[model samples]
Target: MKKITLWLAALCGGAIMLSGCNMLDKANGIILYGDEEKVLSSLKEEHKGQVEKDSLSVKLMDTDGKRLMIMDETSAQYLLEKELLQEVKDGRDTEALSSIPKLAEGEAFLFAKKEDSDIGFDSLPDQVNYEGNVIIGDGRAYADMFLVVADEDFTAFEAEAKTMGIIQYNKDPDGIGGFDVEREQLVKIEE
Candidate 1:
C-alpha cells in the first residue's frame, strides 16, 4: 500500500510539471484565431497558383495588384510580443505613445485577422502609420484574414498593445516556432 501511494504521488507531480511547461512549448503550434489552419488549407486548395510558401507567411500579389501575406496568428502574436518586449526594455512607460517615432518609407508587414472588413487602420493615431487590407481578394478569399502594413509600424503597435494591457508577452526560452538555430539568427532592429 505504501509503495502504491508513493508511485501515485510521483505521477501526479509529473503531470503537474508537464502541464506548466506545455503552455509555453506547445503554444507555437496553436492557432490563436479561430480555425486558422483549416482556412489556410482551403485557401491553398482553391488558389494553387496564387500561393507561394514562405517560412513565416504565405505571400501573393492580389488581383488588385496590392501585395498580400497570409500570415498565421502565432507568427503575428510572436512579432507582437517581440515588439512589446523591446518597448519595455527601452524604459518607456505606457504614456510614451505620443512620442512614437515615424515609420520609415518602406516598413510594413501583414498579420492574421478574421474580420469581414478592415479593422483599425487610419483611426489609429498617425504615429502608428499603418494601413491594412482585408484578406479577401478579387478572385480568392482567405477565411483566416490578414492585415497588411509597412514593417516600420511594429513599434507603434507595441505601444498600443501596452496601453491596452490585453496581451502578456511571455518569453519563449526554446526559441520561436521551433526553428533550428541555423534557420533563426537574431538581428538587431535599428532605430
Candidate 2:
C-alpha cells in the first residue's frame, strides 16, 4: 500500500510538470505568415518584368485590376496567425525561434483573398509616429496574432493603422482644459 501511494504521487507530479512545460512552449513558439515561396517568386517576377521600383505596395490584383491580396511581411504575420500555423510547430514539438519566417526589411510580396471585392487600401494618416509591440487576441476562430513594429515607413504604418484601426491617441481626455475650449463647454460637449 505504501509503495502504490508513492508511485501515484510521483505520476501526478510528473504530469503537472509536463503540462506546465507544454504551456510555456505554446506561448513562446515561432509564428509564420502567408506563403513565403509565393511572395519571393512574385518579387522576382516583378523585378524581371522591369516594374517600377517606387511602388510602395506589392498588391495582388484581380482580373479587373482590383486589389485582391497583400503579401507584405506585416500582412503575412497576420495571415499566419489567422491560419493557425502554430499547429505545425505544435505537431513537430519544437519551440525554436528559427522555425519562424524571416521577412526582409523592404521585400516585395503578394497576397490573395478568397473574395476579390474584399480588398481595400486604407488612407494614410497626416502626422503620426508610433513604435511598439501589439498582441492581437484570438477573436477569429484561429490562433492569436502579434505584431512587432520596430521601425516603420509611411506605407507600413498606414497599413497597420488601417488593419488594426486607429489606436486612440488619448484614452482619457485631459478633463475640461484638455482642449482649447472652456471647462463648461467641454462638459456640455460630453453631455
Candidate 3:
C-alpha cells in the first residue's frame, strides 16, 4: 500500500509539472526559436507599405495595454551612422529588438505612421497588456512609453486586436514589410 501511494503521488506531481510548463510556454509566446523565422515571414507578407517614410517615431505596446518599446528616427540615424544598422536594409529584419541602438529615457528604436484603417485599440488579455506612443520631432523622434502586464495571457488580447483591425505591417526602404502587433493590442481608451 505504501509503494502504491508513493507512485501515485509521484505521477500526480509529474502531471502538475507538465501542466505548469505548458501554461508558461503559452504565456511567454515561447515557441521553438526556429519558429521566429516563420512568424517573421508571415508578418512580412501581411504588412506591406504600412510603414511611413515621413513619420519620425514609433512605439510598441506590451500585452497589458502599456507602452513597452519605442523608436525614433534620430536613433535610427545614429544606428546607421555607427554601422549598427545598415543605411539601407530590408525593413522586416531591420527593426529587430536586438539591433536597436542603446536607448535613454524617452528614446525609440524606429519610426513609422499608423495606417488609417488600422487606427483603433483593443485590450490585452488580463495576463498581458501594452500600449505605445510616438513623438515626431523636427530632426529626431522618440517613443514616449509602453504599458505592459508582464504576465502570459496574450492569446485573448491578440484575438481582440485582430477583431478590431489594429494589427499593422511594417515597411522600410528595401520594401520589405512584416506583420507587427504594435498598435493592435492597444485599446483606444477614448475615441
Candidate 4:
C-alpha cells in the first residue's frame, strides 16, 4: 500500500508539471525563445537551407513582451505573441529580454489594414477583448504582420482562429478574414 500511494503521488505530480508546461506554452503566442536572434536562429534551423540569411524583416516587436512580428522573403510575416521567461533555458542569457522594444504606457499593439484605413477587429474570437490607445507603425516600410492587445486569455481566441482560419492580409472581409470570430468590425486605430 505504501509503494502504491507513492506511485500515485508521483503520477499526480507529473501530470501537474505537464499541465503547467502546456500553460506556459499557451501564454506565449505561437513560439517563445530567448530573444529575437534566438527566434530567428530557431526559424533557420526549423526550415533548414530554405531560409535566406539577409532577407529577414521585423514588422513589429512589442516591448511589453506580449508579441513579435517578423517576415522573410520566402514566407508571410510571423506574428509571435511572446513573453520572456523568468528563467533562461539551455544556458541562454536572461539579459536578452532587455532588447525588446517598448511603447508608451497606455499604448498597446494593434493592427491596421493600412496607415490610412480602419482597424479590423471583426474576425477575432468574441472572447478576445481589446480597448486602449493604439500606436501605429512607421508606414515607411512594408509591414504585413499584425498583433492587437487581447484583454482575455488567447487559448479560445487561438483555437477559434485555427477552427475557422487565421487572418490574412489579402483575403477580403468575407466573414472569414478576421480570425474567424464572425462579424466585420472595422474601427480606426486612431481618431
Put down candidate 1 lDDT per residue, 7-63, tens digits, no spaces: 999999898785443332221111111133433442233221221221233333233
Error of 2 at 149 (Å): 17
Worst 10 residues of 1 by lDDT: 159-168
Off by over 4 Å in 1: 20-108, 111-148, 151-191
lDDT of each: 0.30, 0.28, 0.28, 0.28
Pairs of residues at least 3 apart in sequence or in different chains that clash in candidate 1: 107-150, 107-151, 107-152, 108-149, 108-150, 108-151, 109-149
Q: Which 10-residue window of candidate 4 scores lowest in summed lDDT?
A: 159-168
Task: Report the poorest 10 consecutive residues by lDDT, candidate 2.
Answer: 182-191
lDDT of 3 by residue, 1-191 (tens): 99999999999889878543333211101111112344343333432333311121223454443333322335344323323222212321222122333434332222223212221335422222111122211111112232222222222223212111212223112322223322212110100
lDDT (0-100) at residue 121 of candidate 2?
Answer: 35
Per-residue lDDT tens digits of candidate 4, residues 4-31? 9999999988987864443322110112
What is the C-alpha lDDT profile of model 2 across 11-115, one tens digit per residue? Answer: 998987865444322221111122334323332332121212111222222333442223345544533433322222322232212123444444322222121
Q: Could you estimate the TM-score for every candidate? A: 0.21, 0.24, 0.18, 0.20
| Better by TM-score, candidate 3 or 2 | 2
lDDT-best of 1 and 4: 1
- In Å, residue 98's CA in model 3 sits off its true spot by 24
